[model samples]
Target: MELALSLGDTPKPFSLLDHHSGSQQQKMKDLGFCMGLGSTRNLEDLHIKNMMREKDDEKVISCSSSSDPSSSPPPLPLQLDLLPFSPVLKSPPPPPPPSLSHRPFPWLSKNLIVESGSQSKLVKVIDAKPLTTVSDGEELAAGEYSSPNNSNSGTSSFQMDFSSIFNGGRSFNSRKRDLELSVNLELVDATERDHRACSRGGGGMSDEDENGLTRKKLRLTKEQSAFLEDSFKEHNTLNPKQKQALAKQLNLRPRQVEVWFQNRRARTKLKQTEVDCEYLKRCCETLTEENRRLQKELQELRALKTNQPYYMQMPATTLTMCPSCERVATTTTSTTTTSPCQQAPPTGSHGL
Candidate 1:
């Protein structure tokens, strides 16, 4: 009985199973998961997946908060020293450009002569200068294109080449005596071609005087004049081809034909102007005659208007002398006497 009671306090197999099973199950749950839902990842993969999820959540929060522009501070500047080790990148200093005098180019590119495979210069400016020669001057003016450095040759290679212009030649801004290299260098060559030679090229201008000048033809032949007149009737102006054809047919030069046509046009214009002047004169005379006639008519009308009452009062019959007052008087009717003074002769004896 005692043994049974002691054992009763101690675990029985059936009761032990119940408590142990429950406790073991709780312990197992605390320790690790049970059968997975459907995961295919290992510990490392699952940890990575969890980290990615957390990063996505953080990104979502950041994006949502980013709407308030003032809320976010600017991103911190990247410190180069803090960055990973690299080739320690740095820009190299630029190489100096080649100078003009050191390697001379063609003075005039048009005159470049290619012999076999190499190029040679037909004409070039003197490289040497008056002072320490070209070498000293080149060193002083050695610059990338044009620079502040000025030498005896000028500013740049261009100024140096054209030193004959502003610096070498006569300029308003005169330089020091030692700097003037081009005192009186001629810029333009004299024209050697003769004007008479050009004039002698025409076919009709073959006749020359002792002075080597072509003789002027003052008159044209009757046949030539007639032909030119017919041509003038056809067209006032002539094209180059037509002029050439006309010259060939008339045994004349193109210049002569052209001048003749120009003269003919001038004459025609003058004749037309004269005819117009004559017509205008005739019109003026006709207008003057009409104006005179109209003026006479107007004068007659004005005089008739001024003397209208006289015509109404008097008749064109006869004139008489008044015996009473000795004054001339007019009558209205042709049958009445001309003299009829208003004053009665002694009033009572007026009828006598």
Candidate 2:
């Protein structure tokens, strides 16, 4: 006897044979997926057999459009038809699948655009200036230096010669970022130490190093580099105060801390977006399951009502399971009568 197929029933595996133009037709007579002239007419079945075609076309298009003309598209695979033991059965409408949430990250450009004929036109406005060599105990730049005449300090202004800060220097140059970072570290340390000690702390330090005559390249260990990267993810865009505190904790310079935080913030925002997407996906799945269950219950109730007699004058409540017996029975003014509709015995348990 032929086994009848229903919605969601799995079909027996069958062989797929393929025949096409410009290719020798081959017979796939084994029990595998079939795709050709007389295959299962079910759209889903056909889709399964021809799945490779979808991917194959993409490769063909990409090959045809290649910059080199020697590249040729591969020959299409032949279709196979699986013989069915019985007539094709109509399938039930499938529950709509939940859509997945796609999370995309913002991309940062790694390439820097250098303008033509203007490589040296832009001045590097960073660590080039010496932080320690400022005249007197007060070595503040024009923008950074506040008036000593302010009520906070209540002192007269003194001329701190800053002309030497960039004196005898090339007009515009781009040193390696690491070298600039080293300069920033030395200047911030020397200035901060001197401010606290109230004494010039340049006794052992060389004048050339202080005067930017010699630039030192700084390097970080693997562990230090990894730690800084992790730290920056927690704190983004630190100010002077925050930078100092972070540097104290990490034993790194404020400049290094600042750069790390900048990079970290960008990464954190991207990570947060991905996390949000996963959460939304779980929520979508939960909602989908709930919707499916509710739809199934509604269909069952509708089926039960349709089978009832039209003149029975049974209330809709009769369609519900009995409170005590948990059976589909209708209560009337005269008496409660159990319908021909019988609920499946609660699994293995028989009625009392």
Clash totals, every prediction:
0, 11
C-alpha lDDT of residue 196 in model 2: 36
Task: Give the total clashing residue pairs for model 2.
Answer: 11
Error of 2 at 27 (Å): 64
lDDT of 1: 0.32
- Least accurate stretch of 10 residues (summed lDDT) in model 2? 100-109
Instruction: Kindly list the per-residue Cα lDDT of model 1 for residues 1-352, writing each as its tens digit.
Output: 0000011011122111121235543432232211111111133322111111110111100001011111113122110111111111122322222221121122111112233346322221322211111123222222212222333133123222212111112211222221121111211110011122223332122233334365534345343565566555445567776676555444345666789999987776555445434543554465467569979999998799687877656555444434343333444454544323334345442332
Winning candidate number (lDDT): 1
Q: List the candidates' TM-scores in order.
A: 0.30, 0.27
Question: Relative to the true structure, how large is the alpha-carbon lDDT of every model?
Answer: 0.32, 0.31
Q: Which stretches of candidate 2 lie above 4 Å from their native place? A: 1-220, 229-239, 245-253, 310-312, 316-352
